[model samples]
Target: MAKHARPGRIDPTWPDLPDGEHPVSELAAATQGSLSPFGDVEFPLDDVPYVHPVTEINR
Candidate 1:
């Protein structure tokens, strides 16, 4: 049922797994920060500005 089964969808699980000892390797030093989704290259956690809703009823 997954879209990867169809012709061009390459399942990047095994191949994509970073090379080196787990927990020991930081990955950035090995791959040269190629994998954006893995480390600091990833999108920063959004600090969404808080805006309280105005609940005052109009007279």
Candidate 2:
């Protein structure tokens, strides 16, 4: 069994995901500045930064 973080709280210093979970930030970074195909039109995909809730509240 793996340990899970408590609800409504996340550690920005060590953000760990449960099994089979992938970070959205990783996906965003991987496709950063790429184009998304959208039915005869392509849209630019911008890299959106992910800010933790704690950090956001502190700001």
Residue-wise C-alpha lDDT for candidate 2, range 1-59, written one tens digit per residue: 98886866865666588987775544644455544444334335465456666644554
Candidate maximizing lDDT: 2
TM-scores for candidates 1 onward, in order: 0.20, 0.21
Compared with the true structure, all predictions reach lDDT values of: 0.54, 0.56
User: How many steric overlaps does candidate 1 have?
Assistant: 0
lDDT of 1: 0.54
User: Model 1, range 1-59, lDDT digits (tens) per residue?
Assistant: 65445645655453443666454344535565345544564355577466889899999
RMSD of each: 11.2, 16.2
Q: Which stretches of candidate 2 lie over 4 Å from their true place?
A: 1-12, 28-59
lDDT of 2 at 8: 61
Summed backbone clashes in each candidate are: 0, 0
Error of 2 at 31 (Å): 4.5
